[model samples]
Structure formats: C-alpha cells, structure tokens
Target: MTVNEPTNHQDLAEAPAATGEVADLLAMLAKQRHFLRFTTRDLTDEQAGLVPTASELCLGGLIKHVASVERGWAAFILEGPSSMPDFTKMTEADFARRADEFKMLPGETLAGVLAEYADVARRTDELVAKLPDLSVSHPLPKAPWFEAGAQWSARRVLMHIVAETAQHAGHADIIRESLDGAKSMG
Candidate 1:
C-alpha cells in the first residue's frame, strides 16, 4: 500500500475514539509512533541494535529513546518538570545512564522494547483523555534547552511529544533503510 492508503498495516495500532483537538493530537502521535515502529518490522534483535549509519541510532535504540522521551513528557503533563531528571545537575554517571537508553544492552530484545513502548503510549493516551484541562500548565524545569520562566500547558507538551516522535521516526526510516531495503514511507 502507498502512503496515502487509509488503515495500512503500520497504522493498524490505534487508540480508542477521541474528539476535536484531543483527537487530532492523538491521531498525529499515533501515526508517527506507527511509522517509527514500522521501521523495525521483521527485524531481528541483532539487526535492531545494529548501527548501520554514521549516527549511533539503531532501530531499537530509536524505539527505546522515543519511548523514554514520551514517558517523561507524559509524566510532565501531570507532575510537571519535577517529574523529569535535573538535566542541569546530572553527573557523568547520570549522563552515561541516559545514553544507555539508546542501546539494546545485553539481553534486551526487540520485542521487549516494543512492548514497553506500547505500554507507555497507552498510558499517555489515557492521561490525555482524563485530563480536565489542556490549558493547565507548569513551569519548565531549569535546563539549558528550555527557556527560563517558560510554562507549557498539557496541550503544548503533547505537541512536543508528537514532534519528537516524528523526528525520530524519520531517523528510524533512515536507519532501517541502511540496515535493509525496507522503507516506512515510499
């Protein structure tokens, strides 16, 4: 099927019904998540971990990183920036641990990472639906990347999640093409 085809295999994984802006946001997120997930289709654990490009990102690593990012941002919606690590104060060890999120360390299976991603996605969808107000926001935590005194509503955070997922899905597409001939998009 072409990219324009509705209900392709990649998009078969979907959340329940939502409406209006919430529906629009969730739909975009699911599409990107599916594209990222699609890149790993039929890949072996070793293949998933192989970095075929100059970039360190492997298909499985991309999955792990995206899932970690989404989970943290989803928590931020409810718990605010405090739910995230203090990126400013992280030590070398902490930095190293964060980097490991991109690797399929020994015994880490493709199936396992994908399963974790699915769980995280489900929880994020549920959180968005149950939240009373998308306008509710929190001050961004101190970080080099985040602007000072900036606050983001739940809706804004969700948009960030969608952007992150799409960016990484593009990375995953490249990685997958390098690993094999498969393409998530034509």
Candidate 2:
C-alpha cells in the first residue's frame, strides 16, 4: 500500500516471527532491483547500447558494472577469495578490458543485459542468504581503498551493496527514460 508496506503478502503473513530490520533491508533491495528491471524492460538493443552525449556510461553498462561490484563485495564477505574484477592492481590493459566489459557487443541486446543482471543478482542474493553470521567482522582484504585493516560485518557489506545498487538503479531509470519513455520502480 505504501513504500513502507510489505510488497510480499506472504511475507506479511509471517511478520510476527520476522525482524523489521531484516525485512526492511531485503524489501528495499527488492524494490531497487525491481525498479532496475522496470527501467530496462522495453529498451531496444540500440537504446540499451547507446552511449549518449560523449559519456562512456550506458544503461546496460551501469547494470553490468553494478552486478560486477555486487558479486565482488559479496564474494569478499562470504566466499573468501574474491572472483571480482580487481580495480586496485588493474593495469591499463585491465581498464581496456573493463572498457570492453562496459560496452554492448555486436550481439548484445537489452534482453541480454537483463539476463546477465538477473543472473548476477541471483548469485548475490544466494551469497547473502548463506552467510554464517551476518554480524561477524570480515575484512575486505583486497579493497585497499577501504581503511587498512578495516572490517565490516557481512550484514553491513550487503546493506551497502543494496544501497549502492539502489542509487545506481535510480540513475539507470532516468537514463532509460531519456533514451526511451520507460520508467520503473520507485
């Protein structure tokens, strides 16, 4: 009924046993993801692929980059050795590789980007679901950009990702609307 209200009716039925903090976090994450999906829903391949006004960023690129970030951080907190793109030790070649990763290839379509987003998002969700202890401190060892030896609970990392994703999702929605006439999740 409202932004604060549960979208999942079944979840509401179980609310007596659920913590509001956990539910709110997860719900916000879902809202963000849903908005991203809505924004990209009707984009043509060319629209999704367009890098407008000399900017290197595109809707598809933003979605892919966010997915890569989500997987990277979640892996750091849960799976131990991270499989994410290493921005720290990234060489010129690595930046070049990322340049390619950000652009839509010859065969890439909006549908393809959506599929990739869903796949990455699902993996991120699974990583969060399987955490042994959300409150246990786990240093993001490879992220030197973070304070040296700084630690975060798995919950905090996940919440950060969700918040970051939501912010970018807003950007994607605006870009998509400008590119076409699509709008999405609040």
Candidate 3:
C-alpha cells in the first residue's frame, strides 16, 4: 500500500468481539501500529529520513526498527530460542551491518518500511490467533539486558511487543513534530 493509504485495521475494531487474551493483545498492537503509521502519513522518503533532533532516530528508521523487532519476536515465539541470533557471537562487522536495519539507508523508501511493518503486523496477529496457549513459555534469548535463565510466557511477549511498539510510536511522534510541527495525536 502507498504511504497515504489508510491501514486496514478492521480486525482491531472487531477485536473486542473476539474472545480471549489474543484479541486484547491484537487490539493494543493495532493501536500502536496505527499511531506509528499515522505519524508517517504524507511523508516523503527524504523527509522520513531526516534527523530532526539530536537523537539518531528518524521516522523511517523508527518504522524499520519496529518492523524488524516485531518480526524477530514473532519468530522467537513460533520457533523457540533457536530462532534468536546470538549477538555476542557476531563480529563487529556483523553488528555494523545489522545496525542498518534501524535506519532508512539509501534506496530505502518510507513506503517500503510501512509495507514491511504491515506484513509483520499481519503475521503477528495470525500467530497470536493460532496459539493454543498464551501461557506457553520460552526461554529468553541470552542477552546482557535479560536476567540469566529468564523465560517469558507468550502473553508476556505480546505485552512486551505492545510496550515496544507504543514506545517507538511516541518516539516517531516527537520526531515528526520536530520535522514540521505536525503531531501524531492531539
């Protein structure tokens, strides 16, 4: 879809009618995704990539980062710990290359990032719907930020996703305002 096209979040509106934790999670996810897309509406690629503040983040970069993060978490939920890439094992060059996932690099358009974010949202919703148990647990990936031997239930993961998305959506809003004084929400 074009950057100007409204996102198809009809499912979010119907979420309350659907029973269970998954529906609630999907609703929250949808809300954040909506806000994120709203911030990017009418933006050009150059405008999207503009670093309007002292921070490294830009609108398109935030979009790209959220998509990649959600995709990774969805894979972790579906495929278990083996799905996570071992960051500590990566070479400095590998880290540098992966860091590009967060930025709107040359030739990367805002439309492309929005499309990717939409795809990841669709996949996450599907996964949540099909999951038999929200209480199902998986070992957290080995990371400096995570406690040793920590594990999280699927429900917790969904919550984490919502929190991450909402946090970035806020960041996107601040960046957009700095760009042209346009606010994502009143």
* Candidate topping TM-score: 1
Taking the candidates one at a time, how many backbone clashes does each contain? 0, 0, 0
> Candidate 3: RMSD over Cα atoms?
4.0
Question: lDDT, candidate 2, residue 50?
Answer: 83
TM-score of candidate 3 to 2 decimals: 0.90
Between candidates 1 and 3, the TM-score winner: 1
Name the lDDT of candidate 3: 0.81
lDDT of 2 by residue, 77-146 (tens): 7654354555578799878877876677788776666667667766666555555567866655555577
State the C-alpha lDDT per candidate. Answer: 0.87, 0.66, 0.81
What TM-score number comes out for model 1? 0.93
Indicate the worst ten consecutive residues by lDDT in candidate 2. 8-17
lDDT of 1 by residue, 119-178 (tens): 899889988977778999999999999999999999999999999999999998899899
Q: Please write out the lDDT profile of model 3 over residues 1-186, one tens digit for every residue.
A: 323424532222223234566777888788888888888877889998999899988888888888888888888888877898886687888888677866899999888788777777887888888888988888988878888899988888889999999999999999999999988766
lDDT of 1: 0.87
Q: Which pairs clash inside model 3?
A: none
